[model samples]
Target: MADSSPSLDPVELGAYFDLIEVTSLLRHAVEQQLREAGELSYVQFQLLARLGDAPSGSHRMTDLADGVVYSRSGLTYQAGLLEKAGLVIRTPSPDDERSTTVTITEAGRERLAAVLPGHIEVVKGLLFEPLSRDDVTALAGLLAPVREHMRATPPRSAAPRRRGKVS
Candidate 1:
């Protein structure tokens, strides 16, 4: 007789798939709406939002990159585009000549304010309205461990490689 058994992977069985799907769907919906608003990419909107929350309407480029998951070069490129559009400005950092600071322009603030209502509606439609109060609480609880793990683990550094020399 042969044994029949089932295999279970708890991590896989848990929230990963649902989280990924929900995140992707929400992002897509929000991006679509923001794109239609005519001046901001979703990323640009997020950048502006971050600057709006900063103490002086500005942030160090490195800090902004970390907040938005962009690399330094990536943020530079995005900031350049935003500068050209009059939505943001890059200024020399007083504390560090090597680093630049980004500030949201008045135009950017106005643009974000204009689209925020629609964005919030889309977010509610896609992510929130469908969920009951209990579902939201359950999701928050379920995600806490994943969020904590991500925060606790430092990003991996590249390992040194052995050099090959002619014998």
Candidate 2:
């Protein structure tokens, strides 16, 4: 009988696992920091941060969905939560009758300000503290292609959320 199990090269598997482990740790730390700083979930923080950085203090909900790589319905839920918090406003997109735009409110900006320092410190401590400057640069270069490759396919989250579970 022929052995038919698929095998990845050990070095490739190690690299893949290392990336996953590091990002998992980083994500949990940042999520906790964001929750503590502003009572924001990670997705809410991402949405607010994106809105805060827009040149005109607003962005299309579609664009925000893409920026955060989150499902449109999920982003909508986050937006609603933020709006209820007085942290953001959602209005019809003036440029598109069918689209919505989200703008950061004063409270949103305040929340972002509250979140930034801790976010920066947490990221720096977790992601950069162990790396040399050259390692940082090299890591960015290595990840760029992988990110672009994944982005080319625009994952399912790029679309609206499914209404029901599959049978």
Q: Which candidate number would show the highest TM-score if scored against the true structure?
A: 2
Model 1 lDDT, residue 32, Cα: 88
lDDT of 1 at 36: 88
For candidate 2, write residues 1-167 as lDDT tens digits: 99899887999899989988999999999999999988999999988888888888899898888888887778999999999999999999998988999999998999999999999999999999999999999999999999899889866645555679888
| Candidate 1 per-residue lDDT over residues 1-167, each given as its tens digit | 77578654887766668778989999998888898885678888889989988879999887887778766667788889889999889989999997898999899888888889999999888887999989989878988997787757542222233478859
Best by lDDT: 2
In candidate 2, position 12 carries an lDDT of 88
User: What are the TM-scores, per candidate, against the unseen true structure?
Assistant: 0.81, 0.89
What residue runs in model 2 are displaced by over 4 Å at the alpha carbon? 1-6, 155-167
Give the CA lDDT, 0 to 100, for residue 148 in model 2: 95
